[model samples]
Target: MKRLILLLVSLPLLSSCSDQWGWYVVDPTTKTGLTNLKFLLSGLEQTVLMSFTAIAISMVVGLAVALPGMSSSKGWRRFNRVYVEVVRAVPILVLILWVYYGLPQLMGISIGVFGAGVLALALSDSAFQAEIFRAGIQSVNRGQYEAARTLSLNYVDTMRFVILPQAIKRILPALGNQFVYMLKMSSLVSVIGMQELTRKANELVVTEYRPLEIYTILVLEYLVLILAVSGVFRWFESRMQSDER
Candidate 1:
């Protein structure tokens, strides 16, 4: 709060300098680039779409990978270790470039801006989500497995009926946090012309030539988005807590 107050107080001084040659000012809703909010809205929608698709795909992939990774077999465990390490080690920018540019050449097929963006982010997020699932599943008590065994439940039945329910509760918060991270990372998709919020902001900056104010607006927009996500997470947290009681 203090930082926000200081930032708001300083905006006038920072934006009032004589050297603000590249800065341009226009009516917030009447500027050439921002003449219609439709463009911004379209961009924001694309961003949300990309994040949603990516997160959904990542959740599925993470669960699939995590099951094998968490297996007792040495080979599966080793493969999981390498998979997580390699993916997490690579930078998101590099992953984006590979998916957007390299993928078409490799497969002789093209995924458009939206497809490529979702694929890239999902691939990256899967690594993290796999770890989340692994940790969640492992956190279940040994006694839970023993109880399921006493009921003559097989591994699959045990996981579906006994393990996953508890694991899901523990991992809900982490998944929500991952969704927030994925939302911000979707901005990187702009590099391949996905036209998400950041990309629209760039176009606005170029046309209106107001980097400072435009970027500030963009930051505030993202802050709102993050806060909304956090609010939803809090609601889920409350519900989960109530269930636990």
Candidate 2:
């Protein structure tokens, strides 16, 4: 809060000096500047929506993939290793390009901009999430499984009632980090024209011809978003730990 207050206080001083620096285009008090600011902020909706949807899908896919890594069957375990290695190898920008273009061409099915964005982001992040879950599950006390067995609990019941809750808490911080990663990576979808924050800035730059000022806000938008998200995650993590204690 103090930092934010300091930043807000410093803005006018920076803007006032813009005249000497010849950067008057971002004078937020001016009509043109205010309009540009609003236009950029409007794009935040698309950015947030795309990120949230992608992370939700990633969590589901990641857990499914992570489970096999813990299986007794060698085939399932090998498949898990192969999946994590192969998927994590792909760069997000390349994945976004492939999903938006090559996927439709090969499958004879097309997803729109938003769908492609979510699909690409989720697929790319799921590999990391899988690893996080795998480690989290493995970190659980082996005695947990023995206790479940002593109770005559089936494997499914064991995971559902005794394992997942603990694993989720252990892995949540990593998951939260993945979400922030997904949020930033969503910008790559701008290349395919999702009209999210980056795309919005790109378009505004073309017309407004003020890349410096426009991009500064663009940076701040993401910075504020990431900070707010990290803070929430930390608070949530602390609360969960408190509950456990």
Candidate 3:
């Protein structure tokens, strides 16, 4: 991964001598470029914060929704299906726009750009998270539930103590994938003026007139962020596996 990143970074430098390519705009060695880099990096905090907040909310919401889908009652199962279908049907961008713009008008309550972005992202992702959780919960062996019943564990207690922990472990990879997806999707919030990584890159492109160079850096930023997140998930998975043994 380090070698790949080095190669990608060096590819542009190899062509730096060409007059057609203006690498000076993002050149770390220069004062202007270094300042621009810092400005771009400044948005990382908002991006990470927003994505984490949204994913956290989504996980809870998803678990709640997933429990209903697992219920034997047809009404509850229908409700779960309807919710997942409706939420997933909407494009995330449209949902973001509506939450930021339309929702405020309808509710007669103001929501800031960050709040709206998080809400929209959480709502949109919760649908998929529900499915992931449902699958994970259902994947547990039937004997686990029988054992819980024998121990006099009620539905809630069974889920809380016996089922959810195992389900969460099984779904950790999916959850991590969702988080990475959240990070990427958070970039869309830039359109609503959240000033995240892509927003910062877009602003810089307007100022520097170097779309290729600026966006290249943006790609690297996301690449590094997602790679780091994936590494953490892998570490957690290893730890969990060791604990199981």
Candidate 4:
């Protein structure tokens, strides 16, 4: 993985040696390039913040949705099905646009770009998260539920203490993947003027007139961010597996 990252990072530099490429715009050695680089990296904080906030919201909302679907009542199951189906069917870009532009009109309240982006991301991802949680919960051994009932635990207590812990462990990887997905999807919020990584790159491209060079760095930024996130997830998974032993 390190080798792959190094190779990817080096590709643009090698190509930039040609006269056609304007690598000077992002060259770390010069003052202007360093400033431009900093300007681009500035968006990193917003991107990470939005993605994390959205994913966290989606997890909670998804768990709530999943619980209803798990209920014995047909009405609740139908509600879950309708919600998941409708939400998952919508394109995330369209959802973001609607949340940013249209939702405020309906609610009669203003939402900032960051709030709109986060809300849209969370709502769009909640459907998938619901399925992941449901599968993970269902995968828990039936004997575990039986043991909770034998202990005279109520449904809430059984889920909170006995079921959720096991299900969360099973679902960690899926959650991690969703976080990664959220990171990528957050770029779409750029369309609504959320000043994220892609937005920074786009702005720089307009001023520098070097789309190729600027966008190459943008790609690298995402690549590095995603690789780092994946590494963290893998470390957590390993630690959890070791603890299970």
Candidate 5:
């Protein structure tokens, strides 16, 4: 965390060296640079909001999909396999386009840009989330289930009290990775005019005519966001381990 903070703090200072790199476009020392900085940062809120909403939706859908795979019924298991295989095969970009353009036509409904992006991201990510959830749940010891039954616990009680807690603990790291992945994937939505970080950068690039400088800033922005998320998860996993001990 300290390293991340230091890196962010020093980025602006590098521009002070010279304007040879056209870093002046984003140089916080100048008035135009300060203006451009605010413009670029303006999209941060939307990007974070969109990623969180999509991740929440995907979690619910993924758990629903995962539960069936663990069921005794062969039909449910088959449905789970089919759903995961099919969805994971489709490219997210294509899915986003279809949701934006194709779905409204097919369903006679109006799916706006934000809605389409959320749907596409959630659907695309749910497949991977289901696999992680399925693995986590299945990783629980078989004896745990028998022990729960020995305690007069029913299926639902057993899962709620005994199984899911352990499974969630085991899957925390995987879930964190998926969130970081979702954040990066959310940028693809900017292709459809969602005004996310990438979209804002592109718009600024056109007017400022400084793609090199603007995109350098864009990469740094994501690098900081993703690195911070990664650091937080590492801390969380360590905290969970300490609590277990």
Candidate 6:
């Protein structure tokens, strides 16, 4: 226990050496060299925007797919299963490229880099979210459905009021995890020149000729973002547990 505690305590000190902020000789408020900072910060914002937007779309698509996949109808379930399989099998980066570049020529409608990035992320994330919801829905007791029917609830009403509420409670943690995954995956958007955080880091490296510092800063920003998300999820999980109690 003593050795473990010592090692644990030393971990932060070790990490701080790598991320130690250097002296700031440039004017803090000036926009000269700060152009790099501006672009970097904007990239961070773009990452956040992409993730949140994709997650929003994912929620809708995932739930739509989940509902059909969970239905009693054999045809609908099969259809949804095929969709999930196709999406899950395809690589997301390939999908992003196809959407951004290939689809324009084929469909005669061009999507912007950010739009294609969001679409690709949403398509990928929705498959995962669909499975999450499916598992949550299946975990509900059959007796709950029987009870709701006895109370004169229609199928839709029963799902809306009883099944979904309970399923959502059970799945909240998984849902939060998927959101964090989405946030990290948004960094991939830089491939299509969406000017997200990773792209901004690349731009900074080109201008400042400081690959080490720029990449380090990029990593720190993502670490902070992930930590913030984890903290929020922890708080939300605690509140959910309290509500359950």
Global Cα lDDT for candidate 4: 0.92
* TM-score winner: 3
Question: How much lDDT does each candidate structure score?
Answer: 0.84, 0.89, 0.93, 0.92, 0.90, 0.82
- Model 3 clash pairs are none
Off by over 4 Å in 1: 1-38
Q: Please identify which of the two predictions, 1 or 2, would achieve the higher TM-score against the true structure.
A: 2
Prediction 3 TM-score vs. true: 0.96
Residues 1-245, candidate 6: write the lDDT tens digits: 36645754564456557765331211246665466566677787789888899999998899889999978899999978998899988887888888888888999988898889999999999998898999999999999999998999997899899999889888988998998888888887788998889988887678767675567667767877887888888887787788783
Question: Which has the better TM-score: candidate 4, or candidate 5?
Answer: 4
Local error of candidate 3 at residue 64 (angstroms): 0.4
Give stretches of model 5 more than 4 Å off.
Answer: 1-20
Which residues of candidate 2, in runs, are more than 4 Å off?
A: 18-28
- Give RMSD to native, each candidate: 3.0, 1.7, 1.3, 1.4, 2.0, 4.6
Task: Kindly list the per-residue Cα lDDT of model 4 for residues 1-245, writing each as its tens digit.
Answer: 87967877687677757777778898889999999999999999999999999999999999999999999999999999999999999999999999888999999988999999999999999999999999999999999999999999999999999999889888889989988988999999999999999999999999999998898889889988998999999998888887662
TM-score of 5: 0.92
What TM-score, over all chains together, does every model reach? 0.88, 0.94, 0.96, 0.95, 0.92, 0.86
Better of 2 and 3 by lDDT: 3
On lDDT, who's better, 2 or 4? 4
Question: For residue 12, what is the lDDT in candidate 5?
Answer: 59
lDDT of 2 by residue, 176-200 (tens): 8888888999988999999899999
Candidate with the larger lDDT of 1 and 3: 3
Model 4 segments more than 4 A misplaced: none
Query: Which 10-residue span in candidate 2 carries the lowest summed lDDT?
Result: 19-28
lDDT of 3 by residue, 1-245 (tens): 97867878686877666766777888889999999999889999999999999999999999999999989999999999999999999999999999999999999998999999999999999999999999999999999999999999999999999998898898999989988998999999999999899999999999889998889889889988999999999999988887672
Better of 4 and 5 by lDDT: 4
Better of 5 and 6 by TM-score: 5
